[model samples]
Target: MCSNVIRRMNEQQLIDGCKRNDRLAQKELYDKYSRKMMGVCMRYVNDRETARDILQEGFVKLFTNVDSYLQEGPFEAWMRKVFVNSALEYLRKMDILKEAVSLDQAPEASSSFHSVLTELSAQELLTMVQELPAGFRTVFNLFAIEGYSHKEIGEMLGITESTSRSQYTRARQLLQKRIGKIL
Candidate 1:
């Protein structure tokens, strides 16, 4: 059959092919998910270069760890976890995920912040997030965007849950201030 007539493979097939070291399968997997995964990497990092580096590293980890995939969960979710972990690892190695001073404050989860978010394009919002200090950015991405609990974030970053909450609060305040200026 012609290439165009070949049936498209499912995620498992792709994973299996990758496990067998099939270059075409690996390339196909990369082509399908690189953009989305790049967005994940970029969210944690400040610049494009670092994001690209993290993306490459994440893919390498993905390929090497392909055999560990349990097939019990959504493959994309699994892939996303790998990328997020990779980004976190990069931050830790660079010492960007620092011990944040507890602000002893809570995020103002008000309609104002929501209104600002609604007004901004996704890219604009992402830019605002990227401008935050490294610790704030990491906590914000984990708690706000990724739906990770503060406890989970604390475990991931080796901080206390209270510290995670404090960082998240500070991140929201910074974002609100930046958005206020943008508005």
Candidate 2:
């Protein structure tokens, strides 16, 4: 039996214990990161139930693939990537990205629009993002929040670069319109 208190285990210790298939370590890992990962899942999916499903699936994938972790980067970042990929896979399986459109000229958000975003509370911003249609939300999260390039998002979602750009643009426009109502 693992003698270390799960709560006291550092990240590296957790990773090592998980790699050794210690149940306490796995539970601690999940307890430590599940909420954050759930937020990541929720950003992609609107409903909590679906987000929970994705969160569970992400944890399963993480534990299964723990041995593959190279320890070269921050473990949280690596775990986040796994959860994000899991969410993307769920979206793909549901064919949610099929609605994404392609536009040759995607307009950028104005400087004033960005300033408006800064005025909102984090919950308000999150709610606005959650209200976006799935395609827009997914693209926006990938391009803006996750810091993935349009080309990278395109490759990940199996859409063209123009489509990713178009979705991101549309998402921003929608969010701006929503924010305008609050001002």
Candidate 3:
């Protein structure tokens, strides 16, 4: 409990220093959050190189908009929002997000689709998500993982709510199939 307070104080100091444009604080902040944020980026993007680019761009946005922070919530949450938005923006620019759903793919197998997923580790799950098609992956991460509603994801990705739902369904089916193969 004592360490929690110290860590909170340290985080506050880092936020304050970053708000003032302190270079050391900025570096420290980047060093602290880069790896986790890169994981977030990688969930949306396929390759580490693209994820790194998104991470860098997200940090730039985070620092530039530091003055707008109001301490209404945890700084880490705000930073995460920034990184997620950056990744979505990058996906949009690359024209990788498709709203159209493919009807040709096989129908979902069964409700036990995700049962096999529990056997795999987090890193294995991440790898599985990375293997998904871009549209399905984005919807999956946003809805299934990040807890975003279909409406919110639709708005974020500039697609209809139905499209988001369809993509998410398709993503789950594909994951189920893949995990079955592994098991």
Backbone clash pairs for candidate 1 read: none
* Tens digits of per-residue lDDT for model 2, 4-60: 552678998989999999999999889888888988998988889999999999999
- TM-scores for all candidates: the values are 0.90, 0.88, 0.90
Overall lDDT per candidate, in order of appearance: 0.88, 0.86, 0.86
Cα RMSD for predicted model 3? 3.0
lDDT string for model 1 (1-183, tens) is 576455387667888999999998999899889999999999998899999999999999999999999988999999999999999999989997884535454335544767667878989889989988889999999998899999999999999999898788889887887787776
* Higher-scoring candidate on TM-score, 1 or 3: 1
Clashes (backbone N, CA, C under 3 Å), per candidate, total 0, 0, 0
Query: lDDT score of model 2?
Result: 0.86
Candidates 1 and 2 compared by TM-score, better number: 1
Model 3 earns a TM-score of 0.90
Error of 3 at 33 (Å): 1.2
Q: Write the per-residue lDDT of candidate 3 for residues 29-92, one digit (tens) a residue.
A: 8878998999899899889999999999999999989988899998888898899999999988
Clashes of 1: 0
- Model 2: CA > 4 A from native: 1-6, 100-111
